[model samples]
Target chain A: MFCFIALLVFSVLGIFSATHRKFAKEAFDCVFRRITFRPCNTGFREKVRGIILVKLMKRSSFFAKVFNKYFELIAWIFFVLMIVSTFYVGRGAYNFYLYGNCNGVNEEGFCLFDPTGENNKISPVAPTCGLDTPTVDDLSLANTDLDKFFFIDNNSEDTVVFIGCYVCDFTRKAFPDIEKLLEKKKPNFYFGHLPVKHGSDFISSYDYCAREDTSGDYWKFVELMFTSDIENINDQNYLQEVVDKAGYDKSKIDECLADPETLASIEQNIFNIGNTNIYGTPLVFVNNKAIVGPKPYRVYKGFLK
Target chain B: MNIKKLRKDFYFLQKKNYIYFDNACNSLRPDCVVEKINEYYKEYPVCAGRSNYALAEKLTTDLLGVRKNIAKFISAKEDEIIFTKNTTESINLLANSLDLKEGDIVLTTDKEHNSNLIPWIKLKSKGVIHKTINSNPDNTFNIERLSKVLCPEVKLLALGMSSNLDGVSIPAKEIIDLAHKNGSLVLLDAAQSAISEKIDVKYLDVDFLAFSGHKILGPSGTGVLFGKKDLLEKLGSFLVGGSTVHSSSYDDFELADIPERFEAGLQNFSGILGLGEAIKYLEKIGLKNIQKQKLVLNEYLSNELLKIDKLHIIGPEEASRRSGIVSFYIDDIDSHQLSIMLDRSAGIMTRSGQHCVHSWFKSREVASSLRVSMSFYNTLDEVKKFVDELNNIIKILR
Candidate 1:
């Protein structure tokens, strides 16, 4: 009984080093008292011997004497089982803590995200163990044709959508440069925009680029838009100057711009880009895998594959 | 409910210096429980039910009385409850005994501790399909998602009554009612909930329940599994030998009635006896008072811990939603490494890791977290010291 209590104390408080060392000292003291009678009245071994004598005495005196001779060995077995079982239970608990399973086999594996079981059905790309999820869903504007908006080699077999705002200088320079380099290497390379901007200016810009530009000179039109004076972007007639310079029919461009569906499409594009879960501009994805913001040409070359 | 007074009963909590905040793992046992175990070994060391002696008869009667007390504690009949080694074994026994065949689905929450998750998951090899409904990001059970998965194919829904990761109680009664309407049985893993919250199995009409005694101030290697009486009769015994049967012939045998058929062989009689005393100790303190005191400590800890920078508390930020647990993570420091520092610096013992819910962590890509689980014996002073030490440790580690 005392051994059982000692095991319990050893299990609970022994997680701390100080308490563990104190228990070690107490255990040594207990063992010392069991072997030597110094500073002890009666030890656990003596009590077990007394109990064995009382039970054996009821049968025969000769058997009682014989059993009493090996009582210390019996006490050792009892104490060992108590200590071992306590540790066995502790080990089982530790296993349960680390692996959730008693055997510590984590074979059922982990669901990458959304243990709601909608992970696979939601997106095929969300389960990449070490990769960032390219989470463009059905609501994304990337599914729209680049030719319907601003075309930059829309006939290419491989396409990459670069989500950025023309107000940024990095997008003004990097978009065309990457498109030129990749287009020369593979004739079927396309760079498209799912445009984002800081304010309502994106609506007019997308309306001009998507609806007004019809001669396949949309790339030249966007280039003229980004390089022009920053304050003239919102002016309707000044925008017509940039649009006419890119060789668009001015009356046709105005008629195309009058449709509310053009502005609604741009608004939907901004909303779709916002829903992509990307925080920064100039974020590009080759197929569905995201490339970090505005990398060097050599780095983009590795990602183009 | 008075922490300072209740602290005196526990050998570990009586220490003025050490702070034990891992009660969700294993609670500190009271002196009465230890004394009861010692009394059992000293007075009647003989085995129960297999002997004709006076001590053996006394042992059998005392064991039965302990079962009766446990049944009363959980609002169950003595015949409906069966004792096992721990909650894991209890769940495993139910998983093995229940009549689940091929194409039969068992539903569980994604936030379940491994004890509840692994048992049902292991049944996939036996043609039982295991499906997990997504828990809310805060580790609370999402009833809407539970409703989505409670289809006709679902034979049983095993879930933790409260999350071990975050101490939020699941809406067990509502889930049971919904599952019953779907024609599915419900198994509540009350390992964390049974101690901190009230569990009236009868009122909830829970078909099955499993809980570990060690998590509720009782002895380790002690657990209880409760089932409806008719359901218990329908399920076969997972373990069969010795006391499981009342009579046997050469090739055939009749298993004993409800509870005895499940408790095979010689049981943990000493631990069960100690558990009976632990229940008595809890009842004396009033479980409602214990629950209320834990909430007070949790509210204090939550308010203070929220003030610290770089400390992110898991689960709902509101105190009303959480119970006696607060699992959080600090920036830059790994959870296991930080826990070692806490133990060495201030004698603060906390659990740090996935907390047996690796799937939950994996879903969020969160590797580990530091959990501080409280009990009724914890004090405001202790909580303050823990928070203060945590602030200091973050400073040094950062």
Candidate 2:
């Protein structure tokens, strides 16, 4: 049992040290003999036990005596600990590979693979929005009304709902990757605008008005919004210029933006987006699986199949 | 002798704060011996008898001088000294070269080291008989038992001059005289005894004697086999190679002189030079002084060790009888564990186990014992620290 633990420890240490390599070889031999149901004739266990006892005997004889008496029990305990820790480490590696975070999807807990929680980072929603703090388990798209949102139906069963703020930095950072994934996968994609930053709510309303007009290419207009300068998006004249440049009727968009029904529709859209329990922008639901933050393009594409 | 000043001569003693008590295993080489060995590698490093260049001639002269010096050290003729790898090889050479027929007996004491015991045991394949003379109850040599075993069929009496297990030396002169009276030759295994006991081969009239260089502050892989001139002439060469012969034809060859005929091929020049320097160093220190110093240290160590309960000494009760060694074991504690702990905790080195006399321990039904064999350079202070550390270990282990 002690040889088993020695093999694990010394094999790892053997990589960087020549001295430990000898001990590692001895331990491997001992372990091989034990697994084959033969007695450990190498004396490796006794050698290691004697070394430990000698070191312990230097400090206290009573401790050495106790240690010598219960060495097998102690080795068993350490062996169990080694096995348990190895299992957890293996599980963590598996979760990291699948979810891009060691703690699982949308979890904000510290992960060794992503030490700064960079994969789970988000732009926080303003407190004035009157929303509860979001939990990963609570952020599900089951109760959300998808019909109210602007969506592109590729006639495929797969769907991706991307919620982002036009002015948020993280949302802007995620825009290119998500845009590339959408073009490549061609899923039934939906875009929801949540203005988490100050002075960004008006642009969401404008976006809603522009998308409601059937004569305009809304996706081109939304792409222009994400790619354009923040100052250009914030300028009302520049927004109209972008709207006209994309070949939409500026008067029709303006008339729709002033209508009370448009306001009611935008509020309904916000209520529907809130059903997904989103507390931050750049949250995307791919096939009803909610992922927070701007993950790499591969992570967003992983859910397509 | 100034023990402190003598300790300074040894390089290992100066480099570390260690209590070395394993002198019976191998004594630490002094600076002069190391320098002498280095001189061979640095100056004239070539074959002695074969090469005729200036450097080789000088090396031949230097090697011959070393042989002469070593011969003087043991009071034997220069031509009688044969160089070997160690005492084991030296004894094996005698065992193989001696003219022994089937049914002839080789007698040895019960406590002979494996080096001396195994060679005789190996002769059983050639139909040569091997016998043992039992020791006294306290592990001392029994002269009465030897008289009974000294029969007409006993061709040789092979014995250890001193036992490495407990440091007990036998009555070599009396045994040799008794064996000679019964028409048997005597061979002494002086691997342990040569360090402290003075050996005058001519005076003792011993037929053969063997000792290793490493036991006497000399370099390892060097040993000497000394025999009477006529006796060495009667023995055949065990190993024959380039230098063992003067000239050879297709069918027959003539062997070289006594020492060169026995020392086949190229020899360990550095080891031989270093051993010569060691002999010179020992001559200056005097074997009597070394023995006296060892007795003082061993007596103190034995008395201190005996104070502990359940601790039993291996040899006779008197420290004088055991030379410089104090071999002891506690009933419950393992000697190897104690030896390791002593070294780790206190920087004290000791020998644990059978000390290569496994047959003796097996006969006595004892597992092992911790042996502390001191040298002249060992101080009383070091022995005191060893005792203190040992007591600490015993207390903790118990």
Candidate 3:
């Protein structure tokens, strides 16, 4: 929905290689030091030239007073700006805290105060306020006008899972067309490389289900896609289409699929939220506002001021 | 060594107004190298190996001639030399091709450039154990320290001919002999030292040597990998493509002979021709005389820098161990900031940061430093002017 073409600027040209915490600090430090260190440090003759000229003019006291006043004024200006900038950053962070959604999934595929179940009835779990994830029973009302089945990624913090494989069949990349597009849409996602532990079987693949899921707050999206098709698509419609086409045989995959591994992974993902001061999904923050995938250059430009 | 011509080249550099201290990074292509490339591009630019046409044959012959020239230059056979993109690729080729089994320990120094270090350490994930020998605080090699680290598990000892961070030339002859006595093959990264100094691989008895032509007044995108004939024969090719294979089918393939097997796809023909010209130029000037000039200029710079207060040189004071590079830094100012100031204000170029020897800098516990390197073309006047510039920059910085 965002400017897809314009965001390509960041995907292709931006310095993605520089992302680690240490390097990030070093980058800021490098910029700060560079700006602070230039200009006046030109030449020794240039250095003494002004001072000697001032002294020879018999206005050394006036020159010294001017220099002191100039420095003091500049110092106050930078200090005030820095304080304002810090408070602005603090406010943005406060908003992130207030708006963050770290609750259990609902039928709407979002964490709401009260969520609904398949029969349009209230959820059985009477969730507590702020303490536990809210259920459908706790709902004040339903906003049916909002797009149903739409993924409301209104939550600012999104997590991405990065998967890297060496001998991977990089062939099937274009097949997961929908997932690929989604991955492209939101660059601010996580896909922790599992090192190809999963095999092409239900059990082996589901083993990832049991693997410890860290947090529910961040967007648990996987950017890495492959062309391994589990279902035969005569019409070639992926996900629900593949299941819909399977008909009676869909039971083996869709209905009977209470995959222990998946449940385990959800448990794992949900288990450690807010534990060990774990900062949920990485924020691919551009100019402070949260954006996923490559937001159009205009989205980035809009926030600059 | 014809100081007048060298000065002319230096003036040619000054006319462009690029102080170009990135000599350690990669030296600028000399006029002769540029002409050699022009001759290849203008006269005979054709794809090699597949064709027996006149131009193709000339390209093939010229490329092979470069191989032979490089082999002769380093006392290697033409068949034992494999051309690659740069020093990193050359060492990576060696790393991938070498018969490294699990449990084989790679003995190397902490001061090694990443090009020599990464490829070997990468083998660690494949279950190969890597053991590092410590470099002295002054970036000098200690024979006893290396001897203690060399064990039966040490199948190979990789070394850099000169430390890129500090420009200290290793006692490779002695190091190679020590490794051989322990029954280990040695690979030397001569990317930094090869152009500035004489390299007699046979005399030094090095099992393998890799170098970049760009560092030696040649064009970029050309590197040479040389190994002992027997060792080269034993190693397998990592990359498989058009020229590298002898025979191929849908399912199976046979690799080509030694050097061809290693060199896959289209060759950088122009780069090699230019590299050959660079070698021809160096030979004309003579490595001994070139080495002498660089050392004189280096020593002058190092001595002058020593005169400045708070300016600490990174390497040893001993002239014999150090090459033409001098890495130094001062109090308060970061090396990155200093390098920028030097380039922007004085038009004096220099390299700063870790110099791709993070482990070396980390091991020494010194943060980061600025580097000013010299080649045969650099002179006493440049050194003096550099000192004057430093004095000015430092005064303002302080």
Better of 2 and 3 by DockQ: 2
Docking class of 2: acceptable
What lDDT would candidate 3 get against the real structure? 0.63
Which candidate number would show the highest TM-score if scored against the true structure? 2
Worst 10 residues of 2 chain A by lDDT: A125-134
lDDT digits (tens) for residues A218-294 of candidate 1: 66766676677656765666777877777777767666677566677666655445455554456555555554344
lDDT (Cα atoms) of all candidates against the true structure = 0.73, 0.89, 0.63
Give lDDT tens digits, candidate 1, residues B1-398: 45677778888666567989999899999999999889988978889978999998998999899999988988999999899999999999999999999999999888888889888889999899999888777767889988887789999999889889988888999999999999999999999988867789999999999999999889999999999999999997789989999899999899998899999999899999999998888889887887787888889999998997777898999866778899988666567656765676678899988899989888888767889998888888888898887766555444
Q: Considering DockQ, where higher is better, how would the candidates rank from best to worst?
A: 2, 3, 1
Candidate 3, A146-175: lDDT as tens digits: 111113242334322222221133212212
Index of the highest-lDDT prediction: 2
For candidate 2, write residues A77-133 as lDDT tens digits: 888887897788778777777777887777667788778877777898754355557
